[model samples]
Structure formats: structure tokens, C-alpha cells
Target: MGSFEFLLDGIVRAFELIVTLNPYILSITGVSIKVSGTATLLAAMTAIPLAFALSFVQFRGRHAVITLVNTGMGLPPVFVGLFVFVMLVPAGPLGFLNRIFTPEAMIIAQYILITPIITGITLSAIKAVPEPIIETVYTLGGREKDVVLTTLLEARFGVITAVLAGLGRALAEVGAILIVGGNIAYTGSVGGIGEGLSYTRTLTTAITSETSKGDISTSIALGIILIAIYLFVNVAAGFFRRQD
Candidate 1:
């Protein structure tokens, strides 16, 4: 087939898989959402509070903590994967949890990877809150707690963008989850598509595996889904920013 024809065929096949709910494709998409979604939530919880604390509190080593968070924002995903793999290995320090090669391991790795990104962005957002706005809260009989709350409300949109950014990073990530999650699937059949329910086979890893096995149609389907999700997240973030 000609290149255009081949590309057309792939797009048609991808849409078919999606509309038909191809078992393998659905399973991979599910894993991607569950793992990345959970990690993003966990990261947001931790990062938001830390960001707030860093913004409001004057304490020793504050600069050090900010520096560390900044550094962590750029951590290499593959190196994080290796570190988590080691920590979860049979003889490793946390091996007793026996979470290696599991969805939980993937969550942990992704959480570590995205936490700093969220925290750093959130911190910046909080810092950007106008000093006059904070002072206005205080001028209106607001206490320290009120000031913090008011600042947080003002920065809410930016913080939401930070969380979305982390979610996007988590969803697109493959290296860390691949090492820790193992991308395994159980033997099974679904909708007569001869697909197995995935344990750790997220969309990104599934695309890699499917393409390597010459399942170009499946790969294309997954790639389309992944891009669609990333786009949605970014668009949502932009909307919230505009509202802010």
C-alpha cells in the first residue's frame, strides 16, 4: 500500500478498535488511567501541602528544601525506575512489601516522579499570589490562617494546572512504570479479540510491545488514545487558567 493508504488504514483500524472496545486496547487504557490517576492524586495531596507550607512558613533550611524540590522536578524517569526496582527487589530494603512488578510499584514510582513537578509548580503559583491581595486579607481582620487560605484560593487555578501537568507527565511516562510494573497480562479472552486483561500493561508500554510484535494496528490505536488523553488534560488546564 502507498504511505497515505497505509496511514489511512491505520487510522481506520484505530477508530474501529476504540469504538468496538477491543479487549486489549481497553485493558491497556484502563491500566494507564488507574495507575496514573492514582499517582497524580497522591502527588497532589503531598505536593500541595508542601507547597503551601513552603510558601507561608519561615523556617531553617527552607531554601534547601526549595532547591531539592527544584532538582527533583528534572529527575530522570529511567533512573527513578531503577531506584524503585532496587528498593522493591527481593533483597532490597523494602522488599518485604513484595510489591515489585505490580501496579502498586508503578504507582509508587510515578508518585515519586511527579511529586516534585507538582510541588515546584504549586510553590511557584503560591509565590505568585500578589502581596497586596494577601495584605488585603489581613487588612480585613483576617488572621494568619485566613491569609493562607485566601492566598490558596487565589492560586487555586495555577495549582490545578500543576496537578494537571503532573497527570500529563504520569500518563505519558513509560520508563519508570515499565521497570516497576513489568507490563504483564493474564491469559484470557475478551470480546473475541484474543486479548488478555492487563496487570501492568499501560497504553505506552502496550504500544511498544504491540509494535515490536508487528501489531501495527494495535499500536496505532494506543498511540491515538494516549495523545487524546494528554490533549484533554492540557486543554482542561488551559480552561481553568483562563477562568482564573
Candidate 2:
């Protein structure tokens, strides 16, 4: 086939897989959403609270804490993967949990990678709150708890944006999860295809694996799904920013 026709044929077959909801495709998509979604949720929960503390509480070494957050925000994904892998591998510390090459391990790696991102963004959002509003709360005899709550409400939109950013990062991530998760799929065949249902496989990791193996059709199918996810998240982020 000519190059144009070859590319067109691959795309056609890709859409076919998507339209049919091929079991393997569906499985990896589901796993991607599950792992990224869970990690984003957990990171938000942890980061938001910590961000509030950093914003409101007066404590020593606060600068050091902020420095750490900034540092972590730029941490390399592969490095994070290596760190987690070391701790989880047999004979390594914390290896007794035996979480290597599991979804849980992927979650843990993503959590570490994105926690600082969420925290840094949340801290900035909380800091952006107008000083007068906080003063008004205090003037009205509002306690520290009330002040914190009011600030959180004022920055709610930014927090939402932060969470969405973390989700996007988690979804697009491949390096860390590839290492910690092992990009594992079932060993057996499905529909006579060599690939099986997802075990720890995810869309991003699967795309890399498929493309590297020269399975252009499967890679295109997965790429379509991944782009759809990214579009959805970006749309949501845009909506929330407009609300802000």
C-alpha cells in the first residue's frame, strides 16, 4: 500500500476497535482512569489540607517546606519511578508489602509525583486570597477555623483547577507507571489477538508498548482514546477557570 493509504487503513481499523469497544482497549482505558483518578483524588485530599496549613499557620522552617514543594513540583518522573521501585523490590525496605508491578505501586508513584504539584498550586491559590477578606473575618470575631474555611471558599475555583492539573499529569504520565506498574497485561490472547485483558496496563503505557512493537493500528486506537481523555479534562479545566 502507498504511505497515505497505509496510514488511512490504520486509522480506519483504529476507529473500528474503538467503535466495537474491543475488550483489550476497554480494559486498559478503564485501568488508566482508575489509577489516575485514584491518585489525583488522594493527592488533592492530602495536598489541599497541607496547603491550607502552609497558608494559614505560622510556623518555623516554613520556607524550607515551601522550597521542598517547589523542588518536588519539578521532580523527574523516571526518578520517582526508580525511587518507588527500589523501595518495593524484594530485599528493599518496605518490600514486605510486595506491591511491585501492581496498580497500587503505580498509584503510590503517581501520588508522590503529583502531591507537590497540587500542593504548590493550592498554596498559590490560597495565598491569592485578598487580605481584606481575611481581616474582615477576623474583625467579625471569626475564629481561626472560620478564617481558614472562608479562605478555602474564596479559592475553591483555583483548587479545582489544581486538582484538574494533577489529573492531567497523572493521565499523561508513562515513565513512572511503566516502571512501577510494569505495564502488565494478561498473557493470553483475546479475539485471536496476542494481547489480553489489562492487568496493570494503562492507555499511556500501552501506547508506548504498542508503538514500540510496530502495532500501528493498536497504537492509533489507544491514541484516540487518550486524546479524548485529554480533551475532556481540558474542557473541564476551561469551564472552571471561566467560573473563577
Where model 2 places Cα greater than 4 Å from the true spot, the runs are 237-244
Regions of model 1 farther than 4 Å from truth: 235-244
Query: Distance (Å) between predicted and true CA of 153, model 1?
Result: 1.1
Name the best candidate (by TM-score).
1
Clash pairs (backbone) in predicted model 2? none
Sliding window of 10 residues with minimal summed lDDT for model 1: 187-196
lDDT score for residue 230 of model 1:
88
Using alpha carbons, what is the TM-score of model 1?
Answer: 0.94
Question: How well does each candidate superpose onto the true structure, as a TM-score?
Answer: 0.94, 0.94
lDDT of 2 by residue, 1-244 (tens): 8989878988998999999889999999999999999999999999999999888888999989999999999989999999999999987897999999999999999999999999999999999999999999999999999999999999988898888889989999999999999999998889555989998999999999998998888998998898899898879778867876
lDDT of 2 at 58: 85
Each model's lDDT: 0.91, 0.93
